[model samples]
Target: MRKTVSLFAMLTALLVLLAACGGNQTGGSAGSSGAAGGGEKKTIKFGATAGPYSDMVTKAIKPLLEKKGYKVELVEFNDYVQPNKALANGSIDANLFQHILYLKQFATDNKLDIQEVISVPTAPMGLYSNKFKTLDSIENGSLLTIANDPSNLARSLLMLQSMGLITVKKDVNAATLSEKDIVDNPKSLQFKPVEAASLPRTLDSTALAVVPGNFALAAGMDLTKALKLEEMAENYRNVIAIKTADKDSQFAKDLKEAVQSDEFEKTIDEQFKGFSKPQWMTGK
Candidate 1:
């Protein structure tokens, strides 16, 4: 009878021990707890295009995050679409490749629940030419390659207008401006819209190409070789994007703090020399 009682006691203790072990396992999941608790996540996956944007995260942001007890993993993407998709699907914790305008438009269009954590320094879009040395040398009906994406298309078109190559309608909303908005093209320039990633390659085929800073740098083109560099607006600067639900979480705050740190600015100054500073960084 005593042996039977001992066996029962042992079985009860084993069940309790198993339950305790299961509880510990649940608590050890850093992703769920850190996000919910608004503290440091043990591992953070950052998505970015395979270029300067990714380098910014690697050279500047990752070390800072590691110091804060977070493991930083960078996922390099070849195109603009995937980084945000990864973030939306919870494949990555955040991304640093797109500007606020692009982020807003993409999120609205795709029904993705993502928001900007903070803006970072961005390289300006510029007109590069293998055929012409200057705008003065630009010929009538010269084929010009531009970004097909609506946001970047408008931005490139606006820069062209600023340079007197074209003019958008005075009454059209700038945010949603399209090729149809152009009222005059004094140069009679022909426009060919392609993917932003493909703009760098257009330089070889077209008279001129409007290359965004990130893609241009990624392609190893010298920013100084461009015929003209657009004056970047604050909203046009690239930003770190996180899931909107995580916006108020602790990881979001930490990510913001890292970007705004003086060390981040110093790193930008040293490595990303030609990149334009955002208003927050410039104190403007």
Candidate 2:
């Protein structure tokens, strides 16, 4: 009888301990959220989509920020939306993956006060296809897939217009092209807007597809002779973006310097040979 009673008491104690631990965890999370806005720490957080460029910022820029007596934290964002939203909401200090035009679109769309601080590097988008060797060989009504995201969709459409597949309004900027902007549609190509990374796999399925340079590299698509590439010089340069309030902040300058540095660009050149090829595309 005493043995049985001891076991029951031990079980009761274990249950109580578990409940207390759970409560502590919940309280910890709540405490952090409450204190987030009141912290006096000398640190800045940067958000970037998980990719090579973002890794570059973490590897190169984070150190620079720290050397200047600022604690730096790097946050990775998976989707197109939340990173900028976090920046606007004070969740992160800045973001680096976006281009100038797209940053403007992000600002306008979300009604945020972020602005482009530095043009980092152009990813140089392209039309890659196993079905059609060249644009002229592409059939009328060739099913073309593009990125479905608002920013990338516009980029793809601008490339299509640049290739003469369609015509857009004279006043429409490449950053803001929409399906409605297709002023001329001669070939009547069937447009399929898909996720950016998924387009390379569908290359065999679609007659033609617009792909960003980084994803093309990820998919092992050869651009040496297999595809036509967009020029980075005159347009389509990517940049480091930040909240307008933090535009001139110390961390922003460190990020811009780190990305634009010769050492970092060398890494980009070596890792991504073709699209990151054009030197003029970099902010340096």
Candidate 3:
């Protein structure tokens, strides 16, 4: 009778232990899902190109969001194309890289419903030359390179026009202008359209190359040495973007607020080192 009782006790203990283990697992999972202080935290997956955009997010925005019990996952892309693709497919929650103009053009052309949340800063486009010391030194028929992408190509052309190197057709929209829009090329400057990312690489071969600020920074080109730099304009300021459906979402609001925060502005000043001018300062 005692042996049978002992066996029964052993079975009871085993059952109790199993129940305790199961209970612990359930609690663990619940705790895991909750933040340290016991509330659910939302994770925002933000996409950006791999340079200043990612740097700013890492240095500023990520910490700001995390302090508010949010998790920020930064997805870095090498090219301008994939960040929007990721956002549209729901692979990411938002993106911060392109300007209002680029974002609008990309969304319209790709039939994506992405929209801007807030403007960040302007990385002004610059014209740089390794061969020529001054614009006057550039001879007629000399080869010049510019970004082939629609928005940047137009920006590059406008920069050239501003320098009196070329004249674009009157009433032609600066955002969509092309080589064909050039009504007069006083220098007879031959234009070579290359990938925006490749314009820096072409500096050695081309007489002059107009490079976006981000690309110029990446190539270690001194902005002070640029023959000409495009002035920061409202349309050219980079912005955070999200799906149109998420325009009013809490995540979107949090992101916009975080970037617009004073802390983020300080970070931008520190990280970009005045290379990119904050749009807020310009009131744009």
Candidate 4:
């Protein structure tokens, strides 16, 4: 009888130990899920292209979020597509890089359920030349390097047209405009379409290079050195993007409020000198 009682007690203790371990495992799972859900999360990861945008998040947005009792982390991407991919896969909570138009198109193409949180100050595309001091010095038949992607290429052409170097055919959609849209090339400037990232390198050999702002900044070219910067359209400004489902989440609200904060504008003015502020910022 005594041996049976002792054996029973040992079994009961073993059962209790297993039950406690199971309870702890369940609690851990709940805590992880809670962190991923709406208002409970204390950490946020932001993805950005490695340049001005990433720097903006680090110097400006991160500190604001930190003060609000959140741990902020930034992941820098070298290419455009991966940032959105990372956001969609939950590798990041938000991203700051592409403009609204690009965001919409990319989402459509990839079927991502991400949406913009708020627009931010964006660097504008500019024409740079190591061979010529000014647009006037550009000779007829000079080779010009431009971004091959349709969106950037269109902007490059538009900038050239604005400067009276070329005239695009009327009624052409600015978003889809191409070399074929050019009706007149007064300078007879030959365009070599290359990757946007490669445009900065072309300055060594090409007479002129039209570089998008991010790549230019990444390449360490001075924005002030550009012959001219494009007049940024509102839709062309970069934005903070998050999962569509997170639109009403506490984290999303905090991210939007952070951008709208006066501290953010002050940081932009001090650190991001040449970037064009979004309309909402300027309207304030």
Candidate 5:
């Protein structure tokens, strides 16, 4: 009789131990507690460039990520260089500030530990001018100002090449182009590689100015005002990038899902109507 009573007590203690272990592992016990229900959850760190892009991450993406069981902490940077550097140094898990071209150049030029993981949105820069009402109005010998920065220079010149203003050598690298790179210039248009921000200010000084869509929007010029543009839809494969080592992980999956959420895509459509679209919000 005494032996039976001791066995009953032992069994009850074992059952209690099993229940406690389950609670610790599952974080979903009867009363609710663990790493989830009313318990501490994991976190994800991300960085964004200053401007509307940062706002999108905070207001749209962050909340969606939180819903999927991640505490998203986003850091904002005013300059372009820091985000990639930050990612390289392990300061950030991912960055959403650059397109594939920008990422490629940044990774190559700095030899940073990064890669172009995926494209988020494409910003088709345009040739904006307040002086000349139309492209045809600009004289052939007229001078045009493009961005001097290597990254913007390539994009600006590419737009010009597409519009038949000039032609870059087929063999030349797109990111490190210069005046000598112009293989064909039948129009006799002078090319000036001025600072990107100065391009708009030089509208009167130069016959034409190649301005990025972001700066154009900041300058209050509509897409209709541009003399020429890339056929790429606004939100074409820009990119959301992660470190080279993190390409294969569940964290990458969460980041992808949060950025490509239907809710986030709607914000892209409404907020960046001409500046971006959601057709490129895809990938595994």
Candidate 6:
């Protein structure tokens, strides 16, 4: 009888131990699955040029991302080169200051595998001058400054072409435009290629300067007073970029969603005050 009782007790304890082990195994499997399902990454670092891009992220995108349980860190850069470098080196998870053309050119030139996640508002380039109020007011042989980087230099040249100040070859692609591409210069406008960030500061010295929209805004130039404004196009619209490998990751998707949300649209409208127009909101 005692042997029978001992046997029964051993069987119950064994069953309990087996159940406990099974529970542990199930819990472990669930944890693994949860991670695979993209359990929240605690923080994401976003890089941007110091100005409107950084401002928008802090005032609008940051709060929205925080609501999704992500701690968003906004890293501000002063130049065009550093933001992409930071992104490439993983110092930042993503960047939001460049357009498709510039990003493509930068990636190709540097051999970096970067990709755009979403299109943001555009700060259309503007021709600003301290010496002249209108294009007609400028004289022949006047000095003009433009961005030196290939992408923006091309864009600036195209803007000059559009203003009837110069003309490029009909078959020439705007992205590949250069000073040599200027087949006609009616104004005899001498060109000086300067760093994009310095164009605003050059206004005090140069006869005229073609300032990027963000830099113009930073320097408090009146856009309405610009001699000419570059027409906004899809390629010119600024975008959010990430590593090509992370383009489809959950974090990238979340960022896309956040920027495309109605709340973000309203925030941009209120804060940017038409300094930039959201391409997505306008159905562009």
How many residue pairs in model 5 have overlapping backbones? 5
TM-scores of the candidates are: 0.79, 0.66, 0.76, 0.83, 0.75, 0.77
Better of 2 and 6 by lDDT: 6
What are the lDDT figures for the candidates, one per model?
0.87, 0.70, 0.80, 0.87, 0.71, 0.82
Candidate 1 Cα errors over 4 Å, as ranges = 1-30, 34-40, 136-141, 174-180
Q: Give per-residue lDDT, candidate 3, residue 115.
A: 97
Q: Candidate 4: list runs displaced more than 4 Å.
A: 1-38
Q: Output the worst ten-in-a-row residue range by lDDT, candidate 4.
A: 27-36
Q: For candidate 3, write residues 85-175 as lDDT tens digits.
A: 9889888887889888889989999999999988886568988888888888888898999999887898888888888999999999866
Runs off by more than 4 Å, candidate 2 = 1-43, 63-71, 109-111, 136-141, 148-151, 165-190, 195-197, 214-226, 233-235, 276-284
Tens digits of lDDT, candidate 5, 67-86: 87766778889888999999
Weakest lDDT window of 10 consecutive positions for candidate 3: 27-36
What digit string (tens of lDDT, one per residue) describes model 4 on residues 1-284?
Answer: 99999999999999999999976543222112113334355788889888788899999999998887677788899888999999998888899989999999999999999999999999999989887888898889999999999889998898889888999999899878999999999889998999988899998898899999988988988887998888888999999999897888777888889899999999988888789888899998
| Residue 73, model 3: Cα distance from true site in angstroms | 1.1
Off by over 4 Å in 3: 1-41, 109-111, 133-142, 173-176
Task: Please write out the lDDT profile of model 2 over residues 7-74, one tens digit for every residue.
Answer: 99999999999999976553222112111123222566778887755765676566655665556678
How far in Å is the alpha carbon of 236 misplaced in model 4?
A: 1.3
Worst 10 residues of 5 by lDDT: 27-36
RMSD of each: 4.4, 11.8, 5.8, 5.0, 5.3, 4.9
Of candidates 4 and 2, the better by lDDT: 4
TM-score of 6: 0.77
Compose the digit string of candidate 1's lDDT tens values, residues 144-258: 9999887789889999998889999987777678888889998899999999989999887899999988889989998878999998988888899999988887778788888
TM-score winner between candidates 1 and 4:
4
